[model samples]
Target: MKLRIAILGTRGIPNHYGGFEHISEYVSTGLVRRGHEVSVYNSHNHPYKDDNWNGVSIIHCYDPEYFLGPAGQFVYDLNCIRDARKRNFDVIIVMGYTSSSVWGSMYPKNSAIITNMDGLEWKRSKYSKPVQNFLKYAERLAVKYSQYYVSDSMVIKQYLARKYAVNSRYIPYGADTITPAEREQITPHEARKEDYFLLMARMEPENNIETILEGYNQSNSEKPFQVLGSTDNRFGKYIAHKFKNDSRIEFKGSIYDTAKVRALQNNSYLYFHGHSVGGTNPSLLEAMASEALIAAHNNPFNQAVLSKDAYYFSSPAEVKELVETVQRRDTEKLMVSNNVQKIKNLFSWESVVDGYEQYAMECYLDFNNGKIIS
Candidate 1:
C-alpha cells in the first residue's frame, strides 16, 4: 500500500546529529524506494536545505533551539506538528517524545500517530529531578496521543507494556555490514590497525564516558584509547580536564566522517560501549556490524542485542578487567564473528526499513477500518 507518511522530532537528515536523524535519513529514503510518499521534517538550520532528498520530501521548519535552549525544542516540535496537520499524511511517526509530546494534541486528528518511545529519558543522569519528572509526563502524553508505538529494544517494548498497558512494536535501529577499511583510512588519526581501543558516544553522564575512561586509565594496556564525540559540553570539558595527564587517552572530538569512523571501529582492538540508558543504540549496532569485539555496558537493552556475542561490563573495575584481559583468543574471535552475524540477520538497515513499513501499513489499515483512533 502506498501511504503518505510524515516523520517528525529529529534535527534533520544527512545525519549531522544523533540516532533519530540517522533513522530519519534511512527510513524516509527507504520508504520512498518502496513506492510510498514520505516527508521528513528538518530544522531550518539543517545543513541540507533542499526541498527534497533522494526522492523523499524535506519539510524545513524554523528551529530556535540555539538561542532558546531546551525550550526551543518545543517551538521546533510545535512548528513541525502544525505543518504536519496541513499535510494530510496517512501516518505521522514521532521519533522521540522528549520535546514533541507536549504538543501532541495539535497532531492531526485524522492521521494515525505512531510514537517511537525512545529510551527511558527520565533515567538519564544529566537531567535534574524536575526535568526527569517532566520527561515522565511527556512520555505519558506521547502514549495518550499516539495510536501506535515503536520500541527499538525488546526490553523497552516490555517496559511500555508493563508500565502503560500498551503493546509496542519492536523495531530496532540498523546498520550495514561494514567492509573493513584500509589501514590508511585511520592513519590520519594517528591510529594503527588493531593497536587502539575505541569508543564513540556523546559526552553525557548516562553514556558512562567518565567510567569508561577511568577504566581505560586504570588498565596497563599500551594501546591509545580514542574517544569520539563533541567535548564542548560541560561534562565533556570536565572529563577532558580529569584525564588531561593521561597521554594514552586521546579525545578525537566529534568525527562525522562515516568511513573513517567505521574504519576506527573495524580496526580497534576492542570497542567500548558505555551507554546505559538507550535502547538499541545506533553506535552499538555499527560496532557489531564493523566486526568490533564489544565491551558493552551491562544492561537489559545491550544484553538483548548482543546476547552471548560480546563482553559486558558494569563498573570501572569490570571495564578494567576486560581491557587488560581481552586478547585475540579463539573465543574472542568467535565473539566478533557472532556479533557480525547478528547484524546481518537482525539489525541490517533493510530489515529495519521493512519492519517500519510493515508496521505502518498495519496501523494504516487499522485506522481506516476504525480499529485505531488518535
Candidate 2:
C-alpha cells in the first residue's frame, strides 16, 4: 500500500544532532523511495530550510528549545503533534517519547501511532529524581496512547513486552558500510593510522565519557585519545576542565563531516563506545561499518549487538586494561571483519528501512481491520 506517513520527534534531518535525527533522515527518504508519501517534522531553526528533501516532505515547526532549554522540547513536540493531526497521515511514527508522550492525547486518533521507545531515559544520571519520575510517566503515556510500538533493541523489546504486556517490533538502527579512506584523510586531525584511540558521543552522563577518559588517563599508552562531540554543554565543560592537563587526550569537538569522522573510525587503533543507554546506537553501528576494532560498554544492549565479536568494558579499570593491552591480533582482525559482515547482513540502512516499511504496513492493516485497538 502507498501509505502516507509522518515522522515526529527529532531536531531535524541532515543529522546535525543525534541518533533519532539520523534515523529520521534515512527512514523518511527510504520510505519515499518505496512509493510512500513521507513527511518529517523539523525544527524551524534547523539548518535545512527547504520544504522538500529527497522527495520527502519537510514540515518545519517552531522550536524554542534554544531559549527554553529542555522545556522547549515539550513545546516543539506539541507543535509537531498538533500539525500531524491536520495531515490525516496513515501512520505517524514518533521517534522517541521523552518529550512528546505527555501530549499523547492530542495525537490523531484516526492515525496509527507507532512509537519507537528509546532507551531508558529515566535511568540517566543527568536528570534529577523528579525529572526521572516524569520520564517514567511519559513512557507509560506513550504505551497507553500509541497503537503500535517499535523497539530498536531486542532487549528493549523484551522489556516492553514484559512490563506493559505489549509486543513491540524489534528494529535495530542501521549504518552504511564505509569504504576505507586514504590514511592521509586523518592527517589534518594530527592522527596517524592505527596509532590513536577514538570515541564519538555526546558528553552526557549516561554515555560514561568520564569513565572512558579516566581509564585512558590512567593508562601509560602514548597514543592520543580523540574525543568527538560538542563540549559546549555543562557536562562537556566539566569534562574538559577535569582532563585539561592530559596532553594525550584531545577534545576534537563535533565533526559533522561524515568522510572525516568515518576516516578517523576506519583508521583508529581502537574505538571506544561508552553509551550505557539507548538501543543499537548509530555510532556503534557506524564504527563497526568502518571496520574499527570495538571496545563497547558492558551492558545487555551492547552485548546483544556485539555478542562475542567485540571486547566489553564497564569501568575505568576495564577500559584502562583494554587500552593498554589490546593489540592487533589475528583474532581481533577476525572480529573486525565479523563486525563489518554484521553491518552488511543485519544493520544496513536498506534492511532497517525495509523493516520499518513492513512493520508500518502491518500496523496500518491491523489498525484498519480492528486487530489493534488503541
Candidate 3:
C-alpha cells in the first residue's frame, strides 16, 4: 500500500557521514521507486542542499551543531519533531534515539513511530559516565514512546527483547557487491592489490584503532598496514603519535570516495574490523560485500554477522598471530567466495529496503486499526 513516510535522524543524505545517512539514502530512494511518498529531514547545513534527492522530498531543518557542539543535536532533533508533527506522516522512522528520545513525547500521534535502536550508545568508551547514563535513559524513552522498534543486528534484537521486553523487527544495513572489473579501476596509490593489510574505521576508542596498530606493529609481516579514516579526534591523534615511528603503518585519512573504499576493501590482504560496540556495522558488511577476508573483533555483534566466515581476534597477540601465521592463497580464495555469496543472498540493498517497507506498513496498519500503537 502507498504511504507517506518521513525519515528523521542523521545529518542528511547523499551520505557524507556514517551508517544512518547511508541507510537513509537507499531506503528513501527505494520507497520512492515503489510509489510511496518519502521525505527525509536534512540539516540546514548539509552538503547536499537540493530540495529533492532521487524523487524523495528533503526537508531542511535548522541545525546548530556546528556552533553549539553536542547540545545542538537536541535543538536539531526538536526542530525535526516540531516540524514533523505538522506533516501528518503515516510512518515516521527515527534512525536513532540518541538525541530525539528526549523529545519523544512531542512526536506526532498520527504517525506510527518506528525507532531503530542502534547499538547500545551507553556502552561506548568515548562518552563520559554522565553522558552514558543519559543515553541509557534516552533508550528507555525511545522504548516507551515509539510504536515499534527496529534492530539492525540479532544481538541488538535479543537485547531489546530481554531487557525491555520489547519486540523489534530486525533490519540490517546493506552494501554493494564489488566486481573484479570495478575493483581493478580504483586502487589506492599507497598499496598494491592484495599486498597490504587494511583497517578502515572512524578513529574512536571503541573501534580499537590503537589495539589493531599495536598488533600489526608487533608482527614481523613486511606488508604495510593501510589505515583509512580521519584521525582528527583526540583518540586518533594519540593513536597516530603512538605508532608514528613505525614505518609499517600507513595512515591514509578519511577516504570518502566510494570507489576508493571499495577498491581498498577488494584488494586488501586482510581487513581488520576492531569495532567492539556496534550492531551489524556497515563497514564490516561492506567489506564482506567486497569479498575482503576479515579479521574482526571477537564479540557477539561481529560473530552474529560473520559467523564462521571470518577470522576473529580479541587481543593484539591474537591479531599478531593472524598476521604472522595465516597463509594459503587457496584458502583465502575460498573464504572470499563464501563472503561474496553471503552478501549477495542476504545483505543486498534491495532486500534491506523490502524489510523496511514491510515493517513500516505493518506498524502503519496497526495504528490505523487502533491496536498495539502507543
Best by TM-score: 3
Residue 256, candidate 1: C-alpha displacement in angstroms: 1.1
Candidates' C-alpha lDDT = 0.91, 0.92, 0.90
Tens digits of per-residue lDDT, candidate 2, 1-374, equal 99999999998887788889999899999999999999999999899999999998999999999999989999999999999888889999999999999999999999999999999888988889998999999999999999899999999999998999998998999998886453345675465778999999989988989999999999999999999999999999999999999999999999988877888988899999999887888889999998899999999999999999999899999999999999998999999999999999999999999999999999999989998533
Work out the TM-score per prediction. Answer: 0.96, 0.95, 0.97
Global lDDT of model 3: 0.90
Candidate 2 residue 32 Cα shift, in angstroms, is 1.0
Candidate 2 minimal-lDDT segment of 10 residues: 180-189
- Stretches off by above 4 angstroms in model 1 are 180-184, 188-191, 372-374
For candidate 1, lDDT tens digit of each residue in 134-251? 9999999999999899999999999999999998999999998886443346675565767899999999998988889999899998889999999999999999999999999999
Which of 2 and 3 is ahead in lDDT? Answer: 2
Candidate 1 weakest lDDT stretch, 10 residues: 180-189
Instruction: List per-candidate RMSD values in Å.
Output: 1.8, 1.9, 1.5
Candidate 3 contains a number of clashing pairs equal to 1
Residue 222 in candidate 2, Cα distance off native in Å: 2.1
Residues 218-276 of candidate 3: C-alpha lDDT, one tens digit per residue: 99999899999888999889988999999989898987877768888888889999999
